[model samples]
Target: MKAAVVGLGVEGIKATKALLDYGWKVYATDLQTEIDLEELKISISDAKISTYDEKINISTNNLTIDLGYLDECEIDSSDAIVISPSLCNTKIAKKALSSGKLLSDILDKHKEIFTIGITGTNGKTTTSLILKEILENAGKKILIGGNAGGGFEGYYDLILKAEKGNYDIIIIEVCDMTLEFCDYAFNFDLVGLTNIGNDHIDVHGSIENYKNSLLNFSKNKTTFIDKNQIYLKEFKESNQINELVEYDESNYDLKLFGKFNRLNAGLATAIAKVLDVEDFIIKNTLGNFEPVEGRLKEFKLNDSKIYIGKTDNSDAVKSILNEKYFYATFIGTPRSNEEHRFEILDTVASHNPEIIVLFPGLEDTVEFGLYRLKSIGYEGRIEIANNLDEIISLLAEYSHEDAIFIGGNGQKNIIEIQDRLELLTKNCN
Candidate 1:
């Protein structure tokens, strides 16, 4: 009657507590011996879950749960082993499955909690938030969780909360990385793939493998996929999934930028429809849906407007570009994704924006991205800003006639940029 929680990372911490609540003699597995087990045991759960790491000499009486991952460890003897999505590839994961199934494989244990899972390279956060509102408007007791899906807590913590609260439904933001750790287990009532974009090459080996992993994640589940997504047909042809619904984008009055976001909304709407959300409620949600900050978040000034999308990848930048307005775009980067940076700069080059303001980023790739823009034969003015404040000043001055855009991978610094734009709008008023 004992269970072990593997990998004491974000997901591991929550899983330990959840096992304890499930009335199993619980033990938390950690790699660090110096971690304080007493501080982690709060009074709310009303259970004693001990900690263990065999590598370091740490004293603990709860040998059944703690110190389970060490050599000569008896983790495989446990009745059930719940794992974090991040641990799918580690040596510890290999050991956990040496005798048992994955954490995701046993999700059916919670039969009362219907689940909806969403996956994509972009728009995961935005779509999840919108779905939350739509379900809330329908008066359903909804809960949300996943890797950065919305909650600051880990996926395991959120799952524990949903179970403890007895929610009617749970919406999870699934990722190839997260699902890969668990053999892509779990068949939900509803699933979604927003769009397969150009990223995550290193993890999945290639785009083809990445798509395959996503298809595997949706195996035997009714998936609502974007009609315009480049990989939909490829994904459909590869898998024998018969219940695929192609969500065609409607001309909804969405508040987010680009036709792609409208398409993202379309995917969410299809799921909401299946959930029996009324049409009027869906329309109301979209009309009032504010974009997630730094993901096509809008800013305004007197007679001028700017949209900020946080990334230098072509998929992110190209979505915000409008052909009608003379574009004054601020772009630069850390070359973190060097291949994608070149592709984004190439896309920006073709648009022939009115003015290109190079915002300073703290990466060596920043210089190389700018060089790529110059080598692309951009004939317009490309001004360099030593600081973000300079870029804001430049954007304010040129926004009178041209539609301004700020694109980069520097999301951490965007708050200052947004603050500056808001200040300008206030001053204009």
Candidate 2:
């Protein structure tokens, strides 16, 4: 059999290795030139396969397969096309999808395996992590595969690995884009829909489609949802055959802030209860489960409390402001993400939080963000920091025993900024 794996990032590489293990003629390509092809070649050459593909030349080694840059690479006649979620609408993707079925479609044989699918605009990652902890605490071997902040692995990786049939439970974080490409490919034993709000409007167009995407994917599955969520009323209107388990707010010793986190934990608890996991084990796991980094993490430096969060949409930014009281906040609105800067300022202004615009990697984005803030008639104390170092210096001056909020369309490596702020609170004081 032959397969074409597009986008050789983390997941693409995994898919390539998994395909080679199954002794398939794999064609893996990525437009990204920075990927280490030589290192990947060495890794693929060393893997030993226990489950063999029923094909001729099963003994043929790595030389038969190619994993490199996509220089006019096309999916001519592959058995299946496993694509990254981001490339779903691309012209190449349309051609590939027409040529063959999705790799996820081939993976439906593992539907009998115990699986949990969690999806929402936000909190999907945290909820998935908590569910993994609970299952692992109950002596389950968990295989996590999905986009946390971003989609790492494609369906190719999951489908190839699912053929092994080794894992006790498959816990995946599903997004609308993932479902948008491969519809009804996965049949989850349990599904959790974390609270959804105004997010991914650029992809799904309107608020209603985004909500419907969540409901459409839950067909023929036992889904767990928060009864308190606004979407629940609408989901009930469909009269879907899927079992809906409504979870309520319950508190445990979570090392995170915001009511949304407690809601995420509650969703996990609902799944745990359905799986017959003990309450003591669930509480122990919750108490020990660390917060997904960069999503509401607090760092202490002497008398100052520095809270850092990443909000990609206006609603997320608004939620962070509504969660807790922040005396001063350093906001960085990326030019590409969340165009509603005026609404963001509206949320921040309501809390009366001293706003300091921090420098995103691109200075142009910060400038545009400031332009929008000023245009909104937001007459308040708006300060500026040229870079991370300057932001720390400003934080030191403003660290008069005040609660700090640093949020915006920040990237994943935001723990570094938190550490830098911590150092400032130590030395600058």
Candidate 3:
């Protein structure tokens, strides 16, 4: 057997080793020209595989690594193509799909494991973490990963673990990127949808297409969704689900803030009930569950309380705005198109914070967001922090009695911001 692996990311590297262990000739291609094959070999050489050491001893003569896209010639010569989730929409991936050679065929090996998939435009991480807490307290061995980010294992890792019987249940945080390519490949035992909103328009073309993609991916699976979701009727009318359970807002005592988080807890509680987790365990877990870092994790600095993480979507902003008025709110450039950035600015302006701080994001959308805020007739003070240093200086100006809110939609600078705030907090103490 032979396989052509596209995109030499973490998942692609892992897939290459797995295929080699299965005695397949692997052809790996990546756009970058600087992949260290020897380093990869050394890393995997030390990898602890309980049942595959003998297979790992095989000759490297069958391996071929290249620095370019998988050309048509490579596609013709290979029996299968393994793609990284990020490259699912690339031309090579489309060609592989047309040829019926997707490596997702390997997903069949994981069909017997109990899988719980969690997805939404927002709040999925909070819900997944809550469920992890509940399941762990209930004595269930679970591997939680997939788009939960922040060093959690990914989908391929989960598959490898499932193959080894290393988990009692696998909880996967499904995202639009993965669903675009892997939908219908495996049926989840249970799925929880936090809620869907306008997001990832650049990836899916439009909100309608994004919603349809989610609906299609969720079809034929037992899904748990928010009863209050505007698209609840759409899910009901799709008539594509095996079973649909509407989870209500949980009134359980929660340590996390915001109404949306309660809804997240509600979904988690609903799923835990379906899994037969004890009521005491669910209650205890909810009460004790701390906020997931970067999802509005709170920190205190002297008399001021600072919240950082995940203010990227309108629903998340609305949740925070509704909870209380902030003295100042810092928004990073949203990871979406210009129109969506304006929409987010509108949401923030409606809250009418005393001041709005525009921060740099993964993209250079900050100036546009500032313009949109002004055009929306925002009456509050508007300031732009060109970099992290400026943002830190702005933070220092706020009085101890002031409450501060800072975040954006999946900004890459969030950790740096959080680390700086932690240092500031320590200095105050």
Candidate 4:
């Protein structure tokens, strides 16, 4: 067997190691220059695979590497192509798909393993994490993977673990981009659709296309969807889903805020029920589960409360605003379309926070977001922070006696700010 691995990022590196373990001839290519590849090789050589006793020594006998343009790689000569999630939409990926050589084809090899796939425009990470917690609480050995955030191992890593028979269940957070290419290759035991919203429009080309990609992926699988997602009903009538389980917010006592989170918990609970997790375990796990790091993670300093996470869409913004009173709100430059950014700005403006802080993001996006906020009749105080230090200073000054919401496209930036604020508070004490 032979495989061509694309983009030697985290996923690609894992895929290469796994292929080598399977005794396959692997040809890996990345756009990074030879110098970068050498650096990556050095890192890989130094790193130890926690799953195994040996270090990741890439055997050179059947391994080939190429650097520079992806077009120059001899991908056509390989029997299969394993592409990094970042480059799933590239021309090379399309060529691989047309030739039926996606790395996802290996999914069929793990039919004995029970796989649960969770996907949505939002809340998928929460749902996947929630399910993982519940299952673990019930003493189920499971491997959680995919885009579950917080630097969790991805699908390829899960594959290697699954092959080792170390887990009984696999929970994969299937993002839209992965679904675009994986398609029906994911033969999951059960799948959960948290809810579809207007997201990844740039990647999928349209909301309809994005929804279709998810729907198609769920075809012939026992899928669980939110009962309130009425839009799915029309598609369900046409799609040949094995069994569609409609779940509603059972209103489990949850620490996580917002109705959206309740819906996420509901979907996770419903899936847990199917897996025979006890009701007490599910309830207990959810009640103690804190918000995912980049999903409305709460922080308290002195008397003020701060909530930080990704709030890129109007609905997500509205959900947070409706759940609690925020005296101030911080928004980063929107990464979506101009119309969507305006919608988010308009939604935030309508809430009328005491102050709206526009932190740094893409230079072009920051300028347009300011224009949109002002155009939306936002007369409240608008502060612009040039960097994280400025943002920390602003937070220290304003977040003394009230609640504030920090949301934007820059999740990493938000996390960094949170870390800095925590460190500052710790030093003060």
Ranking under lDDT, best-scoring first? 3, 4, 2, 1
Candidate lDDT (C-alpha), each: 0.68, 0.69, 0.76, 0.75
Q: How does model 2 score by TM-score?
A: 0.81
What's model 4's TM-score? Answer: 0.82
Candidate 3, residue 288: lDDT: 96
As for candidate 1, its clashing pairs are 27-65, 52-67
- Rank list by TM-score: 3, 4, 2, 1
* lDDT of candidate 3 over 52-154, digit per residue (tens): 3222222246676656333558657888777788887777777777877775564456666688988878887788889999999999998787752433555
Relative to the true structure, candidate 4 has a C-alpha RMSD (angstroms) of 6.1
For residues 1-429, could you state the per-residue lDDT of candidate 1 as single tens digits?
555677666566666655665566654566555554452554434444454344443323343434334433445666667666676777777766665545543444433578888887777777888898999998988887677322335565554565458687888777657866422443367778887777656667777888888887777778888776777777677555648888977467987877778877888898999878999999999889987776677777656778776754677666667424546777756545546556767777778887777765436465776678888788887888868768877876886764777776666556568777778778876
Q: Per-residue lDDT of 25-121 in model 2, one digit per residue for the tens?
A: 7666665544654524544355432322322111234423333334234456667766666777788777666655667665565566688888887
Q: After the best TM-score superposition of candidate 2, give how far the Cα of residue 222 lies from its true spot, in angstroms.
A: 1.7
In model 3, the clashing pairs are: 312-409
Report the number of backbone clashes for model 4: 0
The candidate, 1 or 4, that scores higher on lDDT is: 4
How many backbone clashes are present in model 2?
A: 0
TM-score of every prediction relative to native: 0.77, 0.81, 0.83, 0.82
Top of the candidates by TM-score: 3
List pairs with backbone clashes in candidate 2.
none
